[model samples]
Target: MSIFHLMLSSVVIFFVLYAPQPLLAQFAQLYATSPANTGLLMSVTMLPLAIAPICYGLFLANYSKLKLLKVAMMLLALCSVLITLQQRFELFLLLRFIEGLILPAALTAMTSYIGQTWQGQCLRRNMTWYVGSTILGGFLGRALAANFATWWNWESFYIFNAALLILISLRIKLPPLENITTPKACSPKDYLRPLKQPSLLRLYCAVFCMFFCFSALLNYLPFILSNEYNLKDPKLIGWVYGGYLVGALLSMCAPYLTKLHNNNWVILTAVFGVYCVSISAMQWQNLGAFIVLFTLFCACMFIIHASAAPLANEISSAHASITNGAYVSFYYSGGALGSFLPGFIYQTAGIEMFLLSLLLICILGAYFTWLNYRIGSETQLGR
Candidate 1:
């Protein structure tokens, strides 16, 4: 039951986090903004996500996870309701920024709560389910948001999301914080300390590029469909994100893939190479071709994410939470920038040029993976 609630928490947080993505095209038109500028709807939320994990790890080490989770969810629900009433675009962005600040606390609390409550194989199993729930949340959030917009109005989805969040906040349960042992509080320097490790730094850089490309493609995809393909209906636009489910399944397969290759970095490099190929194939003019390739694109990206996260912990077990926190920072930092910056290329140059930019970034990611592999091999030989 606790695990069920934990997974529910995972799903709702992610649902709230990404619910705005499919509506970017609609938001751009409604707010009277350029496609490039409209990207801020995502970037404003992501920027806070990129920075907040470190603070949570450093300062909230001993805080009550259940209390934090409940408060964050309730506040996020309020933000969702406020977004429904917001008329000014700037205030809308401000509300998104506030959502960003609140999200990390919910995420940090849920993950920490898991560590506190479980151990060994039980812990691994729960975490895997947690990851799956987040993927489900991401997919359902986009799919439902667009459909809800088409069925009624854009604000309808937020009203629906707010209701779910409030229910989850009031119902989900967790062990009391006093029952869990408190970790030693970390200092600010601890946050920067992971940057000094070469292998960890290399992994961080690779994931940044990986997510940068992923966010760029997903964030701007609706514009391409509506503007280029002349597919304006939000219901059909939402269906395109059906490819997201492919990612959820592939995430579960990542551990098996690691077993098939002895050098994990080799697998990482190859997976990224495949990602480059899939996105390159997306340059085809047909929407069907784009959707098929997008599915492959999603599969490749999640495999990289599923593999990279555990590797970060393996590389630095002593400071596991901080390492993971820094990983989130770099990953979403790429997302923050990728959510907006690629809009200019897609807007001014075209989709071909936009994809070309992401291809170059993936190539760089592959290089970083190779660097990590080489350094790890050298360290092992020295040992």
Candidate 2:
């Protein structure tokens, strides 16, 4: 039952995360706006994603995780239906922003539930399914948009997602809630202490940098492919995104990799190498080479995300929820920046220069990762 609930929760998240991509083109057409403005559609949702986790972490800390999750999923379903009916861009944005608040709450609840219910190999396996569900959601959402658009309309995509949510809600039996104090009941000063740790600070920075790279690529890749390469087929774009499958695989393998050596160093080296290779690969105009490079980029991204999430929690120890919230806020805040910054870079500088800038950020990320590793080792050894 726990596994079923978890899978259902993952599907909900998958739609939440990936459903917006195909809709970007649709948003552009519906609003008669530029790609840059359509990009803001995603930014609007991400803004709340950046803010809500912290607020929820601090304020709703004692709420029943299962109850909140179930309610959030229902709210998400309602929001999706409402969003589907909207013709005005501003209205759609408003719905998305509200949905964003619901999403982080759901995420927090889900994480807490997983922590409470599972441990060791079970926990790791569940997390792998979670990550895979995210990628699968991305693929399924895009593929549906691409193939089904001709039969129905863009709004049909939301309808489909809503149906799926409803089904999950009906079938899943979430675990009973345990009695606990809400994080909100804690003083503001209590939340601030996690930032004092150098190791935690480094992890926060690393998450920010990693998301900056991943989000930039995700936001701009479609535009680059469509405008520069003149690829118009949405199906093809979905195929390109299929590279995320490699990411799902790599994320599942992360535990094994960690057993082999220092997970931090392995992730740092992979991130740095991926950034350098991606920048070079972006120069190639050929479709085949583009796919290969993008796949490699996606793989590296999953490794970073898979490793960083747990590391952030590990560093926070007693304050895992607050630290996790801080980590998420910084991560998505970087994503919001990445969404818009790449457009500005593309306008002012060439694509290669934009890629180069991301490479530099990746290098900084590597440095921070190493710093965190050394600090963590010292702390452990001292104990």
Candidate 3:
């Protein structure tokens, strides 16, 4: 695929994945619901996000990646439009759920396309753009919805996304992918084989922990800021989210960082170590202190996600597609769990307890990273 096509594809992917978050608070207000219940809007989407990848991994084993992506994008467009029309909570949630199902196919196709066409620095550059697009989409989607409420309505966000999707569909030219036919029959038991590897398992656990922590913050940060900080300006919310720009820059730096040292070390030090410090700093209510800490936290998260994603792909080279699908599935499943657990914990205990819980989870993720490093080193030595 051309560079333009690749960039366009990434934009579409990012918008589809993250465009729902800014609207969550709005949805809650409209429905007269709690933060916990508003979380269902996201939780519902994650269910399909987890399930669709596995099924598509199997079903699309013999299909063309470009064709699959086109279909998936079309489905996503339709769903975005449909979501705008729904007035009832049940209908809204159901449409989001179905939207999730369409995501895995598009995501899988996009990843496979990039993997086949680019490698080394080229791949990393494209992936960075992909990450940036996600950050941009998320920030813009929410900012636009909140800031422009007077201009149109909340549905304008969905409409804008739908229009962007249509433009991408018309312009991007995707390359054909390899078709896996007459493949060796791998049973469900076989699919579980990657989990048997200690390195892979550790990576999976780290992903679960990282996403769980990140999701909790994303789901609750608005409420935290509004309630605790007493900030009512939607534009301020958008600017605060602009902290992700720092993360986007960090993700773009991953390839260079990996060249200097092992990615596992990067994950251990940046993700676990710095992230913990940043989260701990959140206790200080000063605006400057909060911004600095939040920026550091996001930067570390970008480092971890960038490093670990490629490592997940490397863990099972033979079944790269299936392995990637599985990794994303786990990643989002953790997100779903993260979305719900924080609210439950906060309701029962308090925000202090909830944040403390996240701190502990980060420690566990750090431990897993250390173990992964040792195992990888020993295996290399033996070889």
Question: Residue 292 in model 1: shift from native, Å?
Answer: 2.2
For model 2 the local lDDT of residue 216 reads: 85
Local accuracy of candidate 1 as per-residue lDDT tens digits, 132-185: 787888888877897899899989999989998999889956454445353453
lDDT of 3 by residue, 282-381 (tens): 8777776777777777887777777666666555443555666667777787777888788788778866777888888887888787776666564221
Cα deviation of 137, candidate 3, in Å: 2.2
| Candidate 2 lDDT score at position 361 | 80
Would you list the rank order by lDDT, best first? 1, 2, 3
State the C-alpha lDDT per candidate.
0.78, 0.70, 0.70
Alpha carbon lDDT at 78, candidate 3: 87
> If ranked by TM-score, best first, what sequence of candidates would result?
2, 3, 1
Name the best candidate (by lDDT).
1
Query: What tens digits encode model 2's per-residue C-alpha lDDT throughout 170-241?
Result: 665645656564344357677666568877677678778878888888878877888778887977876787
Clashes of 3: 0
